[model samples]
Each structure stands twice: as C-alpha cells, then as structure tokens.
Target: MTTQISGPRGLPLSGNLLAFRKDPLSFLTRAASEYGDVAHIRMGPSRHAYLISNPEYIKEILVAKQAHFKKAKGLQVAKLVVGEGILTNEGKDHLRQRRLMQPAFHRDRIAGYGDIMVEEAVNHIEAWKDGELLDIHHEMMRLTLAIITRTMFGANVSSNADEIGHAIEVGLQYISKKATSVLDIPLEVPTKGNRDFQQASELLDKTIYAIIEDRRNEPEGAEHTDLLAMLLAARDEEDGTGMSDKQVRDEVMTIFVAGHETTANTLSWTWYLLSQHPEVEARFHQELDEVLEGREPTVDDIPSLPYVNQIVQESMRLYPAAWMINREVVENVEIGGYHFKPGEILMMSQFVMHRDPRFYDEPDRFKPERFDGGELLKRNPQFAYFPFGGGPRICIGNNFALMESALLLATIGQRFRISRGENEPAAIPEPVVTLRPKNGMKMTIHKR
Candidate 1:
C-alpha cells in the first residue's frame, strides 16, 4: 500500500507558490523538518510537487528508478537559455552527447589544464592590492570566466568578460523567475522580461558562435588542446559522424554558462565561510603553506592537500551551488512507499539533506574534519551528502569543478586572506538557478 504524504497547507489558487517564492531554502527546510521524508506540495492549482528528502528515495528517483522520470519543468524552461544541449537533452540523445563529450573531461585530459588553471589564477590576482575592498564573488566569477574561456574554448575573453558575465546573469535570472512563475508567458511576446532574456540569449550566441567559427577555420592538421577542439573532432563509434556548428554551439553555450558559474559560487562561499570560521581558515592556510610551500597548486599537489579539499567539501555541504534537483515523473512510480503519477515533480535539495541532523552532527556548523578519512560517507546513506549529485546524469564536470576549486583555493590562499568587514552585513545566499551571494560578497583582501 502507498503511503499518504502530508505537507504544509497552502492557499487554494497558488498553493505553496507564494511561500516557495518568498524563501525557498527556509521553506524546503521547514517542510522536510515537519513533514518527514516525502512531503507533498501543490505548486499550482494543477501541479503536484513532492519534496523528497530520504536518501533511499532520492537514490530511487535519481538512479535506481531514474528512467521513470525526466528533467523537470525548470530545465524545460532552461531550454530558452541553454538550448537542447546535454544539460537539457533527454534519453538517447543525451547519452550520445555525453559519450562524445566524455573524453574532453577525462581525468588525464583535464589534468593537463592544471597549468592553465594556476597560470590564470596567478594572472588574475596580480592586480589585487593589499587592503582592497571588493566583491570577491564578482572577482571569482571574472577569474573563473577567464579560466573557462581559455581552457575550454581556447580563446581569451578578458576584453568582453563583463559583457559575457552580465549576459549570463540575465539568462540565469530570467530562467529562475520563469521556472517557478504560475503564468507561462511565451518568449515571442515583447514583454520586458522576455526582451531581456532574448537579448541575453543573442549575446551568448554571438560569443559562442564566434569561437566555434574561429576553430572551424583552423588548419585541418592543427593541433589544439581545448574542449572545443575535442568536440569538433569527436566522432561517434557507431555512425562516425561529428557535431555540426549549431550542435557545437549548443554544447559550448551549456558549458560556457554552467562551467564557470558553479565553481565561482563554490569559491565565493568558501571564502565567506572561511572568513566566518577562523580556526578552519587557519588550518586551510596551514595546508596550503605546507603542501605547496608558497608555490601555486598543481593537479598532482591536490592529493597532498587533503585539508583544502575538506574545506571545500564542508563549504559545499553548507551552501551547495546546485542546491536543488528537480525531476518530473514521466510514468507511474513508487518511492518511499508513496505512489507518484505522471506530471508530478520531485524536489531534492542538497542544501537540506546535507544539513539534516540525522545524516550530520551539528549540521549547520563549518567542520571540515567530518569528512576526514571518508568514514562519514561509509556511515551514512549514499545520497546523504551529494554535492555534485549521483546517478548517470550527475554533473559531468564534477572532477573538473573539484580540481579547479582546490587549485584556486590553494593558489589564492597562499597569497591572500579574504575577511568580512565589521560594518558589512552577512552575505545572503541567493538561491537562483545556482546558489549565488546576493548583492555580492563584499570583503577586504589582506595580503599574506
């Protein structure tokens, strides 16, 4: 027999839409705390949503019984920005794209980009003066953007970094708003929101397409080490065909948007958390000092700097970049003894699960040692601490993101320490498409 799921009550017309919109992090956290594992929430008059917090059930939806569900409405709306690339593509096409692009992110291939990562970090911090007050969030965004543009597309976007960053921000805001709004306004209508979204889309297209065109013009035998070169040369084993320029553009756009935004947020939050936790920050700095010996971190040096990785792990536990995962049921399925029908949405939040007292002790505190020796993972359920998610469709850039975060943290930590000002208010977690620091993370940069 299926279980009867219960959740917080809502108004008749919009159900929990208003509450969810007001403060999603707090709302979801409360729902999970009060309603148990499977909380049924009515998003709209016709839409049924369930917040699944159980690790076993989450595994069922994302992995064990994943075929029964598909990417939910938010990603469907994301098609407006990312197109039908890997992030939004479904089933066979998605698998095929993954297969083709897998080589570029392989351990060996991405390892080669470590030099570029450190070099970019070094170049980025060269202009940072002692006692400078700046938005570290924006600084990280700019740095990661430069790194991705050079490492992935083999182009330098330093000149247009601000424009590209603004365009991406516009796209993320538009997607976040439209994904939850009850009213479905078509983009064809020339409303201000739609117009801004379209303008952002065009700007992204112009930037990505230009890169694709340049690579296409390269000599046939010219060797290149970037991701774009790999995509252009990738041929399917069965059909032996390559991706067209349009297809390439879709994939590049997906990476260009997703690639930097997530890691930047991770770094920003790490800085904030370190600023708030001095002991943790001291240990983290000690690790960088001992491991790298005042030199920039390399991919190989990562294994020796376990504390740096741990600090990142704990930061992600607190404020995950991809905070929530949504899946829409495509067929009848049963999870945690609750029957789910087609069209119902399942909301799984890394933010909530990572902080659940059942899975973690002193859940809200910043303690990197919890992950020491990887024993906590063995003690808890699989989905209890998924920062990059699990299952087949997990973030493809997981390794890449981890490496970049470690390298950047170590590289930056070696040279400077970021601290929050006494007068500045706490940085608010803005849970947009990705969790970003609202109004930016303003901090004082002290040279070490």
Candidate 2:
C-alpha cells in the first residue's frame, strides 16, 4: 500500500508541458513549493516524472540505491552526439569505461594541467583592452575550449579552435532540440534541421577521428601525457586489451564537450556575480593580491587563495552549469515516502536546491562569506551544495573543473575587474544544453 502524491493540475493530454517549456526553473520551483518535496510531474499524460526536492531523497537516488537506476532518456538522446561514452552508457559498459578513464582524471594528472589553465586565462585577460565591452560568456567559452584542447588532446588547436567549437555547438544544439521536443524525427529524414545537424555532427566526428588517428601513429613509447594518450594506451589489466578507435573516440568526445562547457558557464557566471556584487569582488581581489602579489597563479597557490575558491563556490551555488540531473528508475522503489514505478523518471535541480531558503541564509543574496571557513557544508551537508552532483556517478571532472575555475579566476582577477556593460540586462539562465546565459554575458574590463 502506497500513498498517492498529487501535483499541479494540467490540461487534458498535455499535462504541465506548456508551463515547463515556457520557464523550466520557475515551473520546477513552483511545483516544489506548491506540492512539497516529492512532487509528481507529467511530461506527457503517459510520461511521468517525480521532482525530488529533498536532499535525503536526492542522496538515495544518486548514491544509496544508485544501482537500481540508469541515466535518463535525455542522455539517451545525447548518444546521437557522443555515442556510448560513459555519460550516455549504462551498467557494465559504463563501469568499465569509467574505470578505464579514471586514471586520466586522477588528482596528480589534473594538477599537471594547471599551468595550461592559468596560461590560457592570463593570455585572454592580458588581451582584453580597458573600456572595451565584451561578451564574457563567449570569451570564457573560447578560453576554456583552448585550454581543454591543449591539456586533454595535447594539440595546439588555436588555428581551428573557432571552427571546431562552432561544430560542437551546432551538434549539441541539435541533440538538445531532440531531447526537449515532443516529436523527434528520424536522423535520416532530410528536414532542414536534420540535414544541418548531420553536417555539424560530421564535422565534429571528423575532427575527433583525425585526433585519434594522429595519436595512433605516434612513435611507440613516445612521451604523451595528455588524456587522449592515456585512453589510447590504457589496457584492461586482466585481459590486457586496449579500447577500439570508436571506443576511444566516444570517451574523448564526451570529455571534450562536457569538460569545457560546464566550466565555461561557471566562470562566466562567476564574473557576472562578481560584477554585480562589488564588495565580494573587492574581497576576491584582495585574496588574489595578497597571495599571488602580481605574479601568475600556480596550481600550488590554489590552497592559499581561500576567497577566490569561495567566490567560485558561491557562484556555482547560484548558477550551476548542469542545472538538472535526471535518472530513470530501474526498479520499483519507495523514495521520500512515496512509491515510484520502475519506468518513471527522477529529477533533481541544482539551481532549485542551491537556492532553497531552508539551506542558506539570505538565499538570494550573493554572499561569499558564508563559504569563508567551509561553514556552508557544516550547516547543510553534502546534498545541499552539489553543483557537480554526487554519488558513484558524480562528475569525474569535478576536481578538474574546480581547480581550473579557481586558477583561471585567480590568474585573471589579479589583473582586472569586469563590470556589467552599460544598458545590458542581467543574464538570465536559459537552461539549454547546460545553464547558458540566455543572451550571453556582456561586461566591460577595467585594469586593476
């Protein structure tokens, strides 16, 4: 015997689709507020979902009973772009791929990429002219893309960076459209949308294959320490077999796309938050100045620069890159005191959870001091501030993103202060393909 969970009433056949599509963040927030923590939501009349607002329930789905679920259908659509990489794969295959790719993201290996991260950030910041307005979102996107290309792929892709990035953006937009829409036409259909998607995807695929092929031809035992080399050279300890070209390609593609996008969004928002809150920006600069003192930031300096890290933490709390994480139930289970069917989906929104009034003081205000001594975690616990997610399937690049963001912030913040460009409206989170600024973030840089 299970209790029925009621949610917002909707029109016949459509359910809450219109409301959700119009403004997903507001809809989710309203649902949680109106129907309590475990609110039932309807995507279609037959397609059901449960928006789990409580952290305990989030912990159950992401960590405790993780084995009884799989990545949601949205990620299934992502397969169109990334193939069966760890992000979209499930069960034994996912476990194997995660284990194989784990070493490449190990802390020591991540630390080695710090120089590239700081160098890229410094180069971009130094290139910025005073009194000139810039789209900070696009700037961070390119900088992070360039850093990932050099650090992960070990290729100097500066010449073709824009082309490669445009292709990836188009492919991602196509996949996002498929995931969000009601009617997904077949990829073979020659609709204008479909043709454009295919062309963009082909360009990205060609780029990835070329990288893999070039790496394969490298001299035996050549000094290659990039992530791609690690994946290519990795062997199953028991069977002593390496991944196939397609396998390598899938993993590289997944990392390449996810690795940069999330961090770029976070940094873009960090700058925005800093621009809006001058006092916090002052503290952030103080920390950077006191620690680095006009010198470029090194990976070793990250530990000493507490305020810089806090600004990043608070910024992510406000606008997480991956705002929503969803999972399809694999077994009948009781969660948060309600019954969920095996095929039903479970969703947790970082944007909603991070801003919950119950968790933080002055939840809407930008106050980095709350995170000063790591008191935010003590007050609320792990589930409250999971910008990168949690559990066995937590983002593998969590450490990498945090370190990269902090280094980039430290390296750039030491030199200039970016304020919102005149007459530009505050960036609204669009929540597509990642939580991107709807109109992009516009700001002006001033030398410190």
Candidate 3:
C-alpha cells in the first residue's frame, strides 16, 4: 500500500481551475504556504497533480532518485514545436541524442561563439537612438536570435534580422495546449492553433532546411566557420557517421528556440530588475564602466566582471527562462515519506523556489551584492538556487545563455539606460513551457 500524501481539494469536477486561472503564481504561492512541501491541486476533470518545492525533496526526486521519473506528459506540448531533438526524446534515445549533441557545445566551440556574441550586441547597439521608447525584451530577442542564427546556420542565413524576429514572435505566441491538452486529436484534424503552429513551423523549416541544403552543396572543408559546419563535421565515433539532413534540422530548430528565447528572457528580466532597484543598477553600471572604460566587452572580460556576473546570477534567480522543472512518477515510489504513484505529475517551480524566504533574505528585493561573498547560493542542505533547474535534465543551453547574457549586458550598458514606461507593467508569470513575463516587458531606452 502507498502512503497517501494530500492537499486541500476543492469539490466538484471544476477542481482548482478557477483558482489557477485567476492567478497561477499567487494560487501556487498560497498552496505552498498553506500546505507545506507537497500539495495537490485539481485542474479540470483529469490529472490531479501535486506541486513540490522543498529543495531536498526536489533534489531526491529530480536527481538522486531520478530512476522512478520521466518527463511529465504536459511537456509534450513543447515537443510538438521543438521536434525530436535532445530536448524531447526519452530513455536510450534521449541519452544517445544528448551524447551526440554534447560535442557541438564543447568548451572551445562555446568560447568561439563569444566573439560572435559581442559583435552582434555591438551591431544592435549602433542602430539605437537616444531616448527611444524600446521594448528591451524585443530588442534582446532580436540580438540573441541574430547571434544564434548566424552561429548555427551559416552567416549568410540570417542577415535579414527583422523578418526572422517576426517569425519567432508569431510561433511562440501560438503555442499548442490542445495538441497536448488533456484531450488531443491527430494533426490531420486541424484546429486553429494547429494551423497557425503549422504555418510558423513551416516558415522556420523552410528557412533552416534551405540553409542546410546550401551548406551541403559547399565543399567539405569550406572556410565558413559556423555551428552548422561544426555539426556537419561531427561523427559518432562508434560508427563514424555524420548527421543526416533531418538530424541537422532538428538541432537547428532546437538552437533557434532554446538559444534565442532563453538569452532574450534573461537579459529582459535583468533590465526589469535593474529598473526596479536603483542601488543594484548603480553597482552594475560601476562594474560595466570600470571593466570596459566605455569600450565593448569580450569573452575574456566575463570573469573579471564579478559584480556583473553576480547581477546576472541574481537576475536568473528572480526570473529563470525555463521557470518550472517537471517530472512524472513512473512507479509507485516514496519521496521524503510521501507516496507518489505512476501517472502522477511532479513539478518544481523556479519561480516559487527563487522567492522562498527560507532560502533568500527579503526574497523579493534585488540585491546583487548579496552574492558577493557567495553565501546566498552556497546553501549546502539542498539545492535552493536552481534557475537552470537541478540534476541531469538541467538546461543544456545554460553556458550559452549565460555568456550571451553577460556579453550583451556589458555592451548594452555601455550604450543605453533602461527605464519603465508610464504603464506599471505587470511582471506576471505565464506558466507554460517556459515562464515568461506576460506583458512583453515594456520599457523606454535612454542613450548614454
């Protein structure tokens, strides 16, 4: 018999739908505050799920005790868009794909992208005008997209920045809950979101596949240094074979989605937090000024910018791009004495854990200096600081995301100052495949 873990269940089939729909973060906050580490909530007629935030419990379930879990069914919604890349596959296939993909991001390859990172940021900054009312989120998206597209696809591929940016916006806005909703129909049965998603996917595919086809026609030792070329050169030592056309396409799609949006969100929220708290902004500016003396930053500059590094650290602590980590219990198991059976959903929210008072002092305030002595993130009992997630499933794009964010922050700080517009934008958390700021993160830019 399984030990029955519990929650304050609402009556009727509606379950916690009303509560969840009204305000997800707050409703979740209330649940955790009232019910302790593990609590359940009902959403509609199916999938009675529990949200767990205790760090040790989270570590056990996601890392040390990982054998009993697989990704939640809910995340299939992303796979419909991201395809069968390392981000989606399961069991041996997942392990195999991850192994094949890891070499592409080897230390030298990532460090090589850093020069491209700084150049892209500098180009974006040159186009900006003083005192322009700009959306930092939009700007960061364009910059990161430009960098990733150039790095992954060949340089000739993404020079038309505006068009690619619009395509990405259209795609992310049309996410499919229905496809992976509690109820799903085959892709042949067209739905509104399905149609839009198909169009967006096609547009992206046409753009990517064209680039791969072009690269193939070029000589094997072509001089164009790019991620696509690196990927093309990659061979699985076991069989010594190169990636197929479709394999290349899946990876390109993954890099575009994973690389572009994550860096964009990190820089977006970093600016948002900076605008709200001036003291940290002062220190951030001081670091930027001292480090570069008004010139742009390079990958070599990253480690020296300790406070800037800490500011980015603090920013992700507050607003992780992949805000929630989810897993489904695969076998009847006991974790921290609570029972979980097959088919039950298990989630650890960075949004909730980042703000837990027990982990962070005055958790809502933005204090980059708190990380100066490395005390806040040094907690040993469990993992309280998991913005990129905890365990083996932690985002693979982490190093790429951090380097892109720091480089952009250094360059943008040299060029502009960000401030909030008249509308006090709601920093509402949208809990979908990734936690994002709901209002598009509106802000005005002042040239410095």
- Model 2: CA > 4 A from native: none
Winning model by TM-score: 1
Best-first order by TM-score:
1, 2, 3
What digit string (tens of lDDT, one per residue) describes model 2 on residues 23-138?
99999989988887888888876778888899999998899988878888789999988999988898888878888899999998899999989888877677799888999898
Worst lDDT 10-window in candidate 2: 175-184
Q: What is the C-alpha lDDT profile of model 3 across 1-448, one tens digit per residue?
A: 2655566677587678667656767877778878789988776687767888798999999788888988876556566666777776678766666667777777667888888888878877887887777767778878888888877675544466667666665566555254234455666678776676787778888888888898889875677667788777777767787778887788778788877888788898899888888888887888888889988788899989998889898888887777777788889888888888898778777778888888888888888877887876675345688877767776777787888888889888877789886577566656545666776777878877
Better of 1 and 2 by TM-score: 1
RMSD of candidate 2 to the true fold? 1.3
Error of 3 at 294 (Å): 1.8
lDDT for each residue of candidate 1 in 1-448, tens digit (9 for 90 to 100): 1566789999999999999999999999999999989888989898999999999999999999999999998999898888889999999999989999999999889999999999999999999999999999999999999999999999999998999999999999999999999999888999998898889898999999988988888788889999999999999887998998988998999999999999999999999999999999999988888877877688999999898888889999999999999999999998877898899999999999999999899999999999999999999999999989889999899999999999999899999999999899988999999999999999999999
Q: Which residue pairs collide in model 3, if any?
A: none
Candidate 2 yields a Cα-based lDDT of 0.87
